[model samples]
Target: STNLSLSIDDKFIQSIREELTDLQRRLLTFSIYDKQTSIKDLSKESALFLWFQLFKDIIFQLPKSEESKYEMIEQCRQYYHGNQEELTNIEKFAQTYTEQDSIHWYTKQCFISRLCNKALRTQDIELLYIFRYYIQDLHKRLSLEHQSFRNTELNPPILTLYRGLKLTHDDITHFQSNIDSLVLMNGFFFTTRNYDLELESALKLSKHSVNILPTLLIIQVNVQLDHVIFAKISSQINNSNEDEILFDIDCAFKIHEVYFNNKKNVWIITMSLTNENRLIAGKYIETNKREIEQG
Candidate 1:
């Protein structure tokens, strides 16, 4: 230890203590995010408890105005200043994006999808607030699309969708424990009506890593279901041949069954869109949204 002067003893000690505390916080945060860290998954109730609290702070924090929206886009523009292609896309988005094109921009391989998905999954309040302008528009667009989608006479009464993703043991266990419970999707859920492509993707991902389990989600949606919004958006975007369907952010679904398919060496979970759980969320969230819109 360095020798300290008597006059500086108390102040210097406090400063060093504060520095140590900050350093410790940084280390702990890093460890929490480390891939090797084994963190227990929060139960659905606990996670939703956190979500409602966080949503209260986040959903209302965004300043609604033309300038704030521009500033948000400029922040994204500055973020990708180093990348020429993204820079061009960002500029084009700023000049050309209409509310109807929200899904088109989102489905594109760009920063909007990456940033919004990450912020939504992590529930990063600051980023959520920052991107609120685009997010709101995207959800609005999806709702409009949903109306047209369900009314299409050719569409089936019950639509089945498939998603392929990699999950950890904790992720699988979380679903297992939450059977017959409501799950609020935190991000924009992407799936396709094509089974072969999804299965192939699941197989490829399953082989990529042993630490994560390959999972296939078989989601069934009833066109008559209310209080949830999703749409067949492949028509809205160019060059998308997967017959892609996208569910709006924060849509709620019921998990009916989860099982490991031993033959395929993958976990298959089945879910159905339900309005029963959304009735609870709707009561509170609708209140807040109405207040925000009225203001």
Candidate 2:
């Protein structure tokens, strides 16, 4: 009886060892294939905890690129501190972008464009407009830093609007005004029974020269290309106002740089009239390459 009991205990130990070895083999195989056990097998809270643990482990295993490290540090900081650092390395990262950096920007633009399109479809025009301006701001920062970005095979459709906007500041302003006035200008502003006609008249009056030093003078009569439209115009072409002139000069230099690259100048103008704000942009193809070069 004593011998039989000892034998039974030995067999039980062997069985436990065999079960552990099989389990270890299966776990190793799953890890190799990047498979996780079914979530259905665990409670929701347990699954969430497991996911967080796995995320931490993968983050630790990432290669030691500066960006990767910085991102990891930021994630950990934000996760624990409930906010990001005020002096975040965004500026540093933007400065370091080269032609290779264009891919990442392009990827970012693509993702944002999808979101913007969804907003547009839902008639969330304000949100869509914000997304458009955000992209412009990003591109301007990248361009001003003189970064060369990689060419993307798939161009975003908004690039057409963007290219057109770069023509002259007024051109962008005109485009933005058209969008805004389309939404706001109705007979409600005036007792005129011809509200539709008045809106059409207003749009006609709002048209400005798309040329260099485009005329922006104001007038009284409600007519197309009239002074009444320019009366409320915000930007003036005086080379005297030092601060304003410097801002315009900066824009001029940016156009010069883009022209040299065989690219058209696309300018964006943000303007506010009364309670409404609008964005104007355009694309202007340069014909005087020799003249520009001489200048």
Candidate 3:
């Protein structure tokens, strides 16, 4: 519950109350006050309401109505989902606003960045995918904007402030760092059931840093092992019959247990590196015992 403890400034809250619709405000209130209201329960409209309210203090203009605001939100959602028609509509919408003076343009970028963070925090993989599309879109926009500014030789303080308020290279890097941290944390919670998703997350994390290879390799080995064996080993570890497992780049093997034919079995899983980058591993040791004593 750090989410429960999250507090907004009174001024910001007041501004949100003024700008958000009655239902939107209620959703925000319930999300903050009611501990049982999960983020997933909120509809897309509610999510967009929160997204807009997050930047109420900085945004200079407001959408004319809840319906119009929701339209904007839907456009973003559709664009992220790869709707070609919506993408064209969104591009047209972006062109309607002047890059330096347009609150609409700036808000769109903030919306994407904040939504990505929200998706990551809530562990919504589907939402994360949608946010990623917009993240890439925002990245391209920033790059082009930077190049345009250099070409036009317009480096005014106001334009610089506008760029600072919108997405930047540092902002994208920070967003990606949050993603890497989430992937690494998710890898630790991997089980046989979610092996594919966990492996995908681990692979994405590996692209960010080589140091994660050992951790990824460990999770991969755990994922590839038989579920029955893993279950029994996990149970033994939980029961303290086996010591807690430790993971490292150089640590070669781990010993654990499994059950077969109503008998106790022991297993040793070993790991090694082919080079600085590649990992190889194997399992050995299988001994059944009528009565295996606990540690």
Candidate 4:
């Protein structure tokens, strides 16, 4: 492993050095050094002391005591071993996981630590996917639990950086206000099945005053329209074979899935509308799988 001598908690570092089973230690080390996944690459990249030194900067920030240190190491071990089990039923997992603050903290550290390691060693999109999966999962879970727009504090800082770097069209609207709907079509609903042109159309349309925006991600079919000042969001259907999930707009249109089962329907009815501001928000609800178009 690259020995960057990144500062970390001494006691916590010591526990990682001492308490972890040989296999667990090796797995942790490999996660940091190999820049990718697989038992073969892990074995090849595994380094004991060097890996510990590289994370020194971060580990040192935690409380330093024999007991506290061991506790944190055990937490790390639990995280590495627990994630597969945790993600099985995303809704169930998120509901249970977020209730416990420690799990949330552990989850946050686990990804950042892995990302930091990957940044120093590899150049592959797989790591990026790994990062994205975690983020999307977390976002969905958080939204489900809260059932409202995410507060500024809870938004993942890393995702903000990811958007800034990628410069995707959605990135532009992410920070903007007064925009209500965004549609991104990817398959079966795109014009020529090209998402790029469709995205361009939406971005261009952003110049107009659309109270509620739509982002479509279907293939070859991309479109945008201004919606009524007051609207509610729900999903007549809940599940999808793929990661994508659909939501309903007042039983009229299917939108994208933004939350998990733990949350109720994200129905944002027109609570109030004004010349300067239009607010559409609602309680979270569960959904099923079906398609309906309102006339």
**Which scores better on TM-score, 2 or 4?**
4
Candidate 4 residue-wise lDDT, 32-100, digit = tens: 122122322333322321232223223334343445433423433454566763334333333453322
Worst 10 residues of 1 by lDDT: 25-34
Off by over 4 Å in 4: 1-108, 111-113, 116-123, 130-132, 149-295
Model 1 misplaced stretches (Cα beyond 4 Å): 1-64, 153-155, 282-295
lDDT per residue for candidate 2 within 1-295, as digits (tens), equals 9999999999999777554432221110000010132323443433333332233233334343546434433433443353232223333333464433432432232233234334433434344333333333333443433221112212331111010111244433443434322111100011122323323332332243334321111111111211111111112222222111001000100110111111312222222212111111110012234447889
- Which one wins on lDDT? 1
Mind giving the per-residue lDDT tens digits that candidate 1 earns over 1-295? 4555654897888777654432221110000111121113444454453364347345646556788678778888877889997888888888887777888888774778767766776778788778888887887789888898888924579988987777778778878877776666667777888877777767766565687777788998898787778889888766656688888766666788999989887889898887654455444467668878999
Instruction: Note the residue pairs that clash in candidate 1.
Output: none
Return the top candidate by TM-score. Answer: 1
Reference-based TM-score of each model: 0.76, 0.16, 0.21, 0.18
Using lDDT as the yardstick, the better of models 1 and 3 is 1
- Report lDDT (CA) for all predictions: 0.70, 0.27, 0.29, 0.26
Cα-based lDDT at residue 133, candidate 3? 36
Model 3, 213-294: lDDT tens digits are 3111222232222111111112222223322221111111221211111221111111221111111111000111212332
